[model samples]
Target: MSFYSDDASADELETLGWYHYDLSRHTAEALLLSNGTNGSYLLRNSNEGAGFFALSVRAKDSVKHFHVTRKGNGYVFGFNEFPTLQHFVNHFANQPLLGSDAGTLMVLKSPYPWRVEEPSIYESVRVHTAIQTGRTENDLMPSAPSLGTKEGYLVKQGAIVKNWKQRWFTLNRYELKYFKEKACEEPIRTLDLRACSAVQFDYSQDRVNCFCLVFPDRTFYLCAKTGVEADEWIKILRWKLPAVTLSVSSHR
Candidate 1:
């Protein structure tokens, strides 16, 4: 299934890069909120049921997932029905979508770019579902737990002195540990992911490609080699966090 619906053609799949088949609701929201600007959106299969789809859009400060259901021969979004998904997208591109609130409005500004090198959508969906349900993916799929690990070089700000120093960072399980060297046996510091309140992009520093891991007591500032590297770290770290932390993190 290249697209959400089997009726959608291969041609449509090639043209509609916004259609993310089998993407879980939680994963979709994370992608939009972490990487997209306001009004960025994507379409995906709805968790509600088959033959249903979702419109995940980046709103003012949060990501909203709107239900898209079949209405006879057309597609229904909010109060309107369109002959096709393209028509629905075209209409929303120009018009504002009213939220549940009286005055809240959301518009589709841009489609979040779909990348070819993304990790398995199945694995992402599994992890997201596990987090939401408070169960390990092993329970869901009867496979070995696949908690991911990421290792890279990043500049870290000293907690007390505030001086920046380069370190080898490794994110595994529920902890982010930084080592003095890539092959070092001991980590210089370990930031517990459970204690982490949020992870977000920070530009307050003079250095470029900066992001921070927010703890209740203090924040750890880190700079990657490039913007793409920084985004990768942020996304993986966010995924490994607990559901409550993720919910809080997304609102920021």
Candidate 2:
């Protein structure tokens, strides 16, 4: 479990600055040179919540800096530029660590300038529109259930269809029920279908349905069981489908 994977030489670490270790707090404190810029900075490691600290050195400065701290059950980000030790303490005092936000302070010890090259919202929209309009018989299509009628049915059990390539799939009553049961057991955050390889759809204990939509980096699942559910799923998918297709196309 260490989240940070910075690899640098011991001499490089020393060049950054001397570190003060706090075993009780599980942290290593040190001053770091901001990249290669004239400015300097302080960095501390909470061991990524573990017990070990890794050090590294830099020859330049970073233009932007971000810090992650524990807050509630997740994490919150703090931003600053060449912050002083006093500023660090005051900021931490006002916003104490919460369980939601847990992690060490990642100090960017550089003033290196950078730029982002993300697609604009309008570009994204245009790309998606093109993808939707470009679909043909050979192209991937939504699962059969999503294209079928919107009627509820009684199911006894369910299973995933084999050789399924396209993302949208349907489930029977039992499958729908199973999906609901599984979804209810987990918190909304944990049940994020975006992170899941496939979503389980439960119509009833005996009927289940699931589908997998492949993405460049990951796969998305649809948890629709009934016709209505399928329709709603399709609507959302249709809205996002173009964007996914466009991204894939751009990469290719």
For every candidate in turn, the CA RMSD to the true structure comes to 15.4, 20.5
lDDT of 1 by residue, 1-252 (tens): 643355544445446678787888888888887788888988887767755788888887888878888654458887788887578667866856557554567777888766646655554321232233666654643221126677789999998898999999877677789998898999988888877877889989888999998888998899999998899888878766667665675688
lDDT of each: 0.76, 0.32
Q: Against the true structure, what is each candidate's TM-score?
A: 0.43, 0.18
Top TM-score hit: 1
Candidate 1 contains a number of clashing pairs equal to 0
Q: Pick the candidate with the highest lDDT.
A: 1
Candidate 2 structure quality by residue, lDDT tens digits, 62-99: 22233435332223343432133234334443533222
Pairs clashing in candidate 1?
none
lDDT of 2 at 48: 58
